[model samples]
Target chain A: MDTTVVNTGAEEKTWGGGNKPLNASYGKMMMWFFIVSDALTFSGFLAAYGFSRFKFIDYWPIADEVFTHVPFVHGNYPMIYVAFMTFILIMSSVTMVLAVDAGHHMNKAKVTLYMFLTIIGGLIFVGSQAWEWATFIKGDFGAVETRGGNILQFVDAEGKRVALSDFVVAGEHERVEHESKNGLWFVDEGTLPTYTMQEVITGFESHPDLAIRTQTINEQGHKTVLSREESIKQLKANGIGIVEGANLRHNEYGTPLFADFFFFITGFHGFHVFSGVVINIIIFFNVILGTYERRGSYEMVEKVGLYWHFVDLVWVFVFTFFYLV
Target chain B: MAHAHKLEILRGLIKFKSNTQKIWGVLILLSIITAVEVVLGIYKPESLMAHVLGMKALNWIFIILTIVKAYYITWDFMHMRDEKASLRRMVVWTAIFLIAYLLFILLQEGDYIESVYSSGFVKKDF
Candidate 1:
């Protein structure tokens, strides 16, 4: 008596177990879910960055000033190189979508070509990021860290940045960097900076055209540049250590927090790009071997394309928040 | 299966012949937006520097343009528009709501901390 089946047609409903309510395959839907969660992770990082930046609004380092170097050409070309990197990543996203479109059409040759191009574009972008990081670590102009944990840069009378090597005269005093072999058995000091505090102060005293630029931003939206007399006084009173480039512990640009966020956010994003490239390469070989072609659907390419485009999307935000805003 | 794409962007103001064409169209749009952002960032016009809603107008523009670019990348490149409405809302709405809420709370707290640092009796020298 209980064996009779009901004709309610539950399977025909959108929410029924057999129906694809989202009009997407299980694998595709899972990819989307992963992307959604990944997006949240990235937003968390960016939001934390914003919080730190807002906390130090008055002395936050300007993005334009921090990223000013080009590959070959130099001389204060701010935002140029980063703009180039953005374009490269966007162009690669285009190639990725095109690969997906070709996959939809089951066009093996086009997918291969476009996937190759996308991989190349990703490589170029990752290489550029590495170059940018190298340049940032190898700073051009050096500065001094005050006793109060603030940065003090140098500028000329015209308010142009001056490198420490330009005027710092080496002194006769000899000092050795602490090493594990010589100093405390377990404690070791970091690499010594190029110039000493005394050397910088002496050089700055002789150059009347030079000035001290503090990390504080004035009402005019620039670093507060002290006069010659004030520069001497501040350097003598507060200058405690020399800081030449950027590291996790210190930064010549401004607060150490700026470099920390820059490395963390961009480093995380760069790792994403790298893994995307590896995935693209794997799919590239699969396409070459006709794996998807034999499966009667190139959906594998589409899934990977979704991942690739997600990477590009994250870069767009990183570019805006880190570079533009 | 061949998927049909909604071959138009900008609320159908621009139409493309095919999905491939649409991809190129969105790329161009993204590029133009990026270029505009870079230009504004470089110049930082005195007019736009004025605070509009507790932020520089220029920064507001950059954030808005960035959202526009993100929309196209998701809608066009990721084929969000071709998917069913249920899927679309599931992905976009969730991320948007969560990120907005997080940003608001964090930024407000950060501003409060800044005020404390500037005005409170806590000694900064230490």
Candidate 2:
């Protein structure tokens, strides 16, 4: 006797049971949900940032002052560079939307082109973030100097802040002596960077004229507008290194927290964009080879389109919070 | 899962548009809104720039406009609006609840931390 077997798929069991109005696959719907959850996660991080801002309202670093440096420009520039980055990501989202449109029309070439542009846009945004990070970590106005071999900062005389460099002078670069390679105890054995924290300290000591400004001081503490006697006294004090977490406040270049979140969240998102690009390339090849035309539809593009747009949607919020707000 | 494939998906760009003109119209409107937001952010007009309800005014506007854009991206661009109400509800409602919960908890916690800070709980000077 012969038996007949039924191959009814999960779709039969109401992965979306009947009475479902829109038709979408389990995966696409799930993608949307994942994006929603992820969006909340990002918002959580940002909200925490805002809360932190309120706590540190007085000494919070000015965004414009901190982020004034621009590539290829000798002097300072405001948020122009990052603003351009925001535009790039948004435009890329538009292109992704258009790619999804092309997918709907069965226009593979247009989809591939738009997808490539989106990938390029993502790469540029990531690069901009990297540049911002480097500028931040290196810090403008340089590090401050302190009497206790620590660096410090404060609000300047003009009611604006200034770096310790405003008070101190950097010593000439000098190498510290260590035991010879053949006789030294193994101390990680790695080569040292040209400048060590110790070298920075020595530089501070040599420049005694640098004033000691506590991180607790306001912007009114750093300017040369003081009375002649006070200016000379400020000139006579030693400089200190910048305080810990000075690199992490809401400051001249926007908030360092802004940089931090922009990097972390956008980095995570960029990873998605990078991964999406790789997947799009794979899909592009299949489309080019007429795989979908033979199989009969281009729903894959639409599915990915949702992910692309979600990334863009998240960026809009990130951009607003970090740059605008 | 088969529908998950790009080849199997539908091109939704303007499939439901009453006309091509309407599609362009929506696109332009979205663009204008974005421009307004960007400009407002840069200039920080007094009317909309001050803090509202304790939060920064710019922040409020950004959050509101961002939510609006998210809605359009979902409903219009992604065509989630055309989806079954159950499906739409699952996505939209869950996000609404989750986001609301997240914002409330984090903001409150943040404020608590700020209060602690103001109370001199965490010493700034080393």
lDDT by residue (A143-262, candidate 2, tens digit) is: 443453323443344445555454444456555556766565665444433343444454444544433333332443221233434433432465322332224443223335545665
Chain A vs native chain A, TM-score per candidate: 0.93, 0.70
Where is model 2 more than 4 Å wrong at Cα? A1-6, A9-22, A145-169, A178-262, B1-27, B46-49
- Candidate 2: residue A179 lDDT (0-100): 73
- Each prediction's RMSD over C-alphas, in Å, is 3.9, 6.5
Instruction: Determine the C-alpha RMSD for candidate 2 after optimal superposition of all C-alphas.
Output: 6.5
Judged by TM-score, which candidate is best? 1
The candidate 1 chain A region of ten consecutive residues with least summed lDDT is A171-180
Any runs in candidate 1 off by more than 4 Å, and if so which?
A1-18, A177-183, B123-126
Q: Candidate 2 has what TM-score?
A: 0.74
Per-residue lDDT, model 1, residue A234, is 87
lDDT of 1: 0.91
CA lDDT for candidate 2: 0.60
